[model samples]
Target: MSTMDYDEHESKFMRKARENPFVPAGMAGFVGIVAFGLLKLRSRGNTKMSVHLIHMRVAAQGCVVGAMTIGVIYSMYRDYVLKPMEEQKALNHK
Candidate 1:
């Protein structure tokens, strides 16, 4: 793709990320954990690559689940706490 096309695609991705920040957070967490796992992997005497792979998979899944949990908490705080405060402030002003 050309530079302009790449820029457009990046912008679209950023817009989507802003709309739902958890997706990017989860993706970043998964990628980061996987990269770390790959870097740490060593095929030595008693260790199996399959076992390491399974551990990495589980860690990545945990990262995604953590991100989802945080996202839900943030949504709840925004809706239940911040929104009502804003509404109350608006009512006070009127």
Candidate 2:
């Protein structure tokens, strides 16, 4: 693709990421774990590649789940805790 096309695609991706940050977080986690798993694969002496693949799959899934959990907690905190505190402060000022 041309530079302009690449930039446009990236901009669209960033816009989507901003709208739902959890997707990027989960993607980053999965990519990071997979990369790490690949790097460590060569050192596995006497271990089957299938076993390593299974482990990588599990770890990547865990990363995505962890990201989702964190996102939910943060959303809850913003909605339940921060919003109420801000509303209270506004009431106090009035």
Candidate 3:
């Protein structure tokens, strides 16, 4: 068996990439949309075609709300915590 040593240091770009807020927000939006769609479909019978329009609207609203909530929370965390940590790390590294 061969053993290798890995660098513990992280680059600035890599750190920034790790702090990406879009992934969580996008996933939340996708999940919200699907859940809303399922709930709407289950609650309303499929007999009426207009129900689909309502479902779409509800799903879209859920997606938008989910994405906005997640995005805002992450943005706040990134700005207040991650950036400061990165700055401290950079200073320590130097």
User: Tens digits of per-residue lDDT for model 2 on 51-91?
Assistant: 99999999999999998898888889889999999999999
Candidate 3 lDDT by residue in tens digits, 1-94: 1123323586655553456656555556777776766676756665575767676767666776666677778799889999999999999999
> Which whole-number lDDT from 0 to 100 does residue 26 have in model 1?
99
TM-score of each: 0.77, 0.75, 0.44
Model 2: residue 10 alpha-carbon error in angstroms:
9.0
- Candidate 3: global Cα-lDDT? 0.68
Task: Report every candidate's CA lDDT.
Answer: 0.87, 0.89, 0.68
lDDT of 1 by residue, 1-94 (tens): 3556445556777866875799899999999999999888864347788888898999999999999899889889999999999999999999
Give the true-structure RMSD of model 3: 8.5
Residue 24, model 2, lDDT: 94
Q: Give the lDDT of residue 94 in candidate 3.
A: 94
Clashing pairs in 1: none
Question: Which of candidates 1 and 3 is the stronger one according to lDDT?
Answer: 1
Q: What would the TM-score be for candidate 1 when compared with the true structure? A: 0.77
Please list the Cα RMSD from the true structure of every candidate, rounded to 1 decimal place.
5.9, 6.5, 8.5
In model 3, the runs with Cα more than 4 Å from the true position are 1-46, 90-94
Q: lDDT ranking from best to worst? A: 2, 1, 3
Q: Score residue 9 of candidate 2 by CA lDDT.
A: 50
